[model samples]
Target: MSENRLREDLCFWAKSLFDRGLTGGASGNISVRTEDGGLLVTPTGVSMGRLDPARLSRFDAGGRLISGDPPTKEMPLHAAFYETRQSAGAVVHLHSTHSVALSILPDTDPDNAIPPLTAYAVMRVGKVALLPFYVPGDAAMAEAIRGLAGRRASVLLANHGPVVAAKDLEAAVFAMEELEETAKLALILRGTGARPLEAGQIAQVVRKFEVDWD
Candidate 1:
């Protein structure tokens, strides 16, 4: 896709996320790997609801800002995924409600934030890691992601929200939505001993969809 079109697509999906309350204020960031092997990212302290295509932050393959507004202070979070995951074409981080709420629950699993609640979640988002809370924008968050060594494509920050990476901008957003919805389902079923997908069912879905299971 052309750079102009990629910028437009990013803005379109970003506004969709904002309008649906997936992210509010400047609580999220998005980046897409450009065809030139660079990146077009949302600006720092900007709402996803009102991003400007022309003013999006542009970074060269060397990681230098070549144009547009400055990138987010939480950029290292995006960088960690791009560096570790060779095929990560885009990354989306959102301060989504249910996912963040799930991260705060005492019983939520750290290694797998949400259980195998449904086949769609397993196929689209895979296992969602729940990492310890770090101060927003702390480099430690990036280091923690590095610890995962790119095995996890989605992670929920304790008391924060979720970060998801996929092969492109649209896929990243779709996976983010799946993660959020599954988190909501997990919260709803808390203490119910909810019967998630059986081991065999999960295996079938993973194999059928070729899920990126870590």
Candidate 2:
């Protein structure tokens, strides 16, 4: 896609997330990798629901801001994916309610944030790491992501939100929705002794499904 079109698509995706109540106000950020290795990102302090395509921040492959206004304050969060995940083409962060709520539960796994209760979650997100909480926009948040490196594609920031990396903006958004859905399912099943998909079953789906949103 041309740089211009990529910007438009990202804005549309961002707005869709906001419209669907995935993220409210200006509480989320998204970025897409351009064909030339640069990035088109939503600007800091802008509402995801009303991002202007022409005003999206542009960053060269080397991480230099090349055009438009400055990028989101969570640049380090986005940069961690591009730097660690070889196939990541986009990164999305959202303050979706269920995912954040799940992250705070005392029983939530410190290593695996979401249970493999559904194949779609496993396919779209692989493993959602439960990262320790840090103040939003704090540099430590980025360092926490960096700690995960290549092992996971999505992470739930404890007491905060979920961040997902995908092959493109659309895939990133889709995966994030799945993350929230899985979280909601988990919440609804709590204390019911819900028979989650067995580990062997999850492995089978992982091997059989060609979910290449890497």
After aligning candidate 2 to the native by TM-score, how far in Å is the CA of 33 from where it should be? 0.5
Task: Give a tens-digit lDDT track for model 1, residues 90-177.
Answer: 9999999999999999988898888899999998899889999899989999999999998999999999999999999999999999
Each model's C-alpha lDDT?
0.93, 0.89
Where model 2 places Cα greater than 4 Å from the true spot, the runs are 210-214
- Residues 1-214, candidate 2: write the lDDT tens digits: 8887898889889999999999998899998999888888889999999998989999998889999988899998999888888899999999999999999999998777788888888898888889888887889888877887677889999998999999888889899999999999999999999988887878788889865322
Clashing pairs in 1: none
Instruction: Please name the candidate that would achieve the greatest lDDT relative to the true structure.
Output: 1
Clashing pairs in 2: none
lDDT of 2 at 73: 92
- Candidate 2, residue 144: lDDT: 79
Q: Estimate each model's TM-score.
A: 0.98, 0.96
Candidate 1: residue 89 Cα off by (Å)? 0.5
